[model samples]
Target: MQAKHQLATPAKVLESYRSPLNGARLQQEKVENLALSEQIDQFIYAYLQFNSKYQNATADGKIPHPTKAKLLSQQRNKLDTELETLCSRSSSIFDQKERGKTLVMAVDEYLLTFLQLSFVGQRSPNTLEKMIGRKKRLLEFLTYKFNIIDLSLDKLQYQFIDQYYTFLLVQKNVMENTARNRCNV
Candidate 1:
């Protein structure tokens, strides 16, 4: 009886060890989605700001104007569709069994495109790496502070970035120049 009980205990332990339980947050996918959403929001903000200024200038007839309004409208529509797609991709974050490779790839492509469009030219490798690192830190901080399991665009704010920088200074003991470099990087 004692020998049987000992063998059964090991078997039970093995069974529990192999139990299929996966409730932990998918942090990588969530962070990636959040970053992609941030990129989209930043691009839209840039586009709208420029479009508004361009429209105002055209209305004032400051120069020999072309049909820039049509171009802006087309870009807005495209951004709307992309935003919808981002929402759809974010929805997948809740589906525990679903793999997000396609969603990730799409976001990656859009992010690269957004970077190219925003820069309009080549960037130094250091600058590009710094931007990526800052984004990574921001996502990590948000995840820690907010228990943000899903990377939704609505969670991000300009104020969050400021708070995150402050967090690095006070909590991480980062110096002013180091914090500024990390934030801007």
Candidate 2:
């Protein structure tokens, strides 16, 4: 199924279109197709084919809705991040030579992707559970505290680390030592 993007009026478009940078980044790594959903693969293919479509479409200087604009920005950032990862990885499941291989890959490669991963399943259920939990907390801290919906790991600063630490200690009621330990984890 195709993802539905809303149509906007000319008045809702931006003046002087420009491509935006990704809000988050992933480390360099090649991945198997089994690790990626076909929807994401298709989205990447389609987005690549029309990299400038968003710029062209936003001709005026406004957005039809704030939420729609936010969503668009998120999607654009995700595309940038994945493309950057593919570039840095030097290979892809889509690469002919990579058709059949057992490569050592980090779980972060897929976890950090814009796509959602279920909290259940995985080789070690506890690891996956903790990952999902920490991710949720980090996202909540960024969004609720900083009003930052699109988290740019590349732009993460000490302020974020501090805020997260405080959040752990105060909001989550984790001991200071335990919060530090969790951060270490």
Candidate 3:
């Protein structure tokens, strides 16, 4: 009786965890993917440090430093290969939803890309997060109001953007500067 009761309790807990509309797991997966990308960046940085050291030694008349050069080259190759693998893995995680002949990405995918780019550019964490959050809100508005399925720059016309700004004004009651800042993201 005790074992059966314990099993039932777990089943009940799981029942609450699997909401059809809950995207927590999907978001968590995206965060994990972004963390992996950050790891790749660190590896690349290490490779760069090795390369810098090798370059400095070569500049100082130390020609053919075989061991250090070989180590740097190997590290760089490994980082490059790892980056490729991570990119492939990330792409595989995205679902292809056809929206008017364009592939629309999920919010998590787009946000993850934004985060990766920011990190690659060496942006501060606060700045990156702020920019990403702004872009996210804009994407949400486009998705909800205008049925905008894709976030292609070519797809964003002045008229649509104007309407979005108006939405921020009328619906969200945000300031003009805030709206402009969000669009800038």
Candidate 4:
């Protein structure tokens, strides 16, 4: 993990983004910032444990047990998916409007497209409004957790489902029952 340039920054993220930096009144902002820091910590810890397990399995130049090898493969795939989900979220935000990148639809943009197809005409005005509000919050959480500001579903991973669940509980400070209701949306 330390050998990779990308992985090197994981530790710094937690420090830089931690809440209560100056002990000031922006307490809400600081609390909200916890999501990204926790994401980095979780990613690095998971990667290191996975790496160590893989290394120990083959340390003696012996073939891993079939079950161990299969488990390692599954872990490797999960880590790859997590890394891709994190890295792909980082794009040159500045180059887009200048380079005609705005013309290309992102996952967020597709939200409206799907809404039209699924709910716009079929649902009542109040129902459509609630649906849009839920989706907006979901997209906002995606941006917070993954640094994925655009509507890009390709950057999403199964891991994010759990991350978003935690984000609601932690950063959003939703009540247990309220979180269940919000998450179900």
Candidate 5:
């Protein structure tokens, strides 16, 4: 009765049904079939294959010791989590493209699109220059915060806005009003 109850628990039941591959086979197949243009996607596919082979080797007692196997498994799990994060970020970008949405991959691209669509001839040259200056400040902040000029819009969150505002005020030594203006842009 106790064994039945233990097996019936949600966690145990879920674990029992989960594939040992943890859907890596399906993800690998998808990666193989998709004509991935990004170099990152290709790297991810290679990593997936390497990870699968590593797991198989470990299971075949290549590691030989229980402790070392456990340690390697822990490290592998951490890498797997990071890989999943990368996959989700890249997949979301691809999905956005497939949906026929205007894909703005970087801050500068988004700024250009916004200006072209909304204020090309309507705004004065001075006003456009000021807008561009604001965008430069934003790009500076993004570079300081993320180390990358090209960031996916999908990865941005409310906390990013808050952090950028703080970065402008503290790191750039800008006034609160100026920080607010930069953030609003």
Candidate 6:
């Protein structure tokens, strides 16, 4: 039937579907995808320019020898193949969430989520303030040690704890008990 065919169309199916996740997360994902797409476009433009120049040079006999020109052509072909493969694979990158692989949350984002949940659970304001203060100190240490404010959880190691403890004791010159509490936080 005409109505059945309309319902089966890709655009209609997408329009009728609703996602359970929050809008902010979806927006963030779209932003990341756009950035990646922009990067790919830039690479493709650069490749086209390079290919044009290579073709012009080959036609004008600017390349010194036939053997060298052949080598250069082979390398160019290999690069073109790589670009095509990348373009083909890029579509699946956004589908990683459906493939059961969890995306890594940055340290700051993880902390913010934790704080938000704690607040929603009616945690004491004093406790929340202490957590915020500790987070600030931890961020400071992270920046000092790695030159980064936010890091992926997978990048952390057991040594990070020891290093952080030492930083609190030595850099902040806090009491041992205070340093321990901060580390616990």
Candidate with the larger TM-score of 2 and 4: 2
**CA lDDT of 115 in candidate 6?**
39
Candidate that would win on lDDT: 6
- Cα lDDT tens digits, model 2, 1-185, are 22235455454344213322321212112223334433344444455344345444566864436675676777767766765665455245434442332211222344434222221112443344455456557656767787853443446577767778988999989888978976664
State the number of backbone clashes in model 5: 0
Of the two candidates 3 and 6, the one with more favorable lDDT, higher being better, is 6
Residues 68-95 of candidate 3 have per-residue lDDT tens digits of 7787677657756765666676566554
Each prediction's RMSD over C-alphas, in Å, is 11.8, 21.5, 10.6, 22.2, 20.8, 20.1
Worst 10 residues of 4 by lDDT: 99-108
Report lDDT per candidate. 0.56, 0.49, 0.57, 0.54, 0.55, 0.58
Q: How close is candidate 4 to the true structure, as a TM-score?
A: 0.33
Model 4 residue runs over 4 Å out of place are 1-121
Candidate 6 lDDT by residue in tens digits, 122-179 = 4543454455567668768988988874554456788888899999999989899999
Cα lDDT tens digits, model 1, 1-185, are: 24544655767777757764442444555566557566555654554465455557567566524666666666667766665666466445434446444423344444555554543435433344445555556556756777653444444567766887888898778899988877653
How accurate locally is residue 136 in candidate 3, as Cα lDDT from 0 to 100?
53
lDDT of 3 at 110: 53
Which of 1 and 4 is the better model by TM-score? 1
Better of 4 and 6 by lDDT: 6
Model 2 bad stretches (over 4 Å): 1-14, 17-123
Order of models, best lDDT first: 6, 3, 1, 5, 4, 2
lDDT of 4 by residue, 1-185 (tens): 46434554766667557754554634432332344334433554565566567768999897999999998999878777775564343233212443222211332233333333332245343443454455556767867966664333355566766777788889888787776776664
Which run of 10 residues does model 2 get worst, by summed lDDT? 22-31
**Stretches of model 6 off by over 4 angstroms after superposition:** 1-121
Q: Evaluate model 5: give its TM-score.
A: 0.40
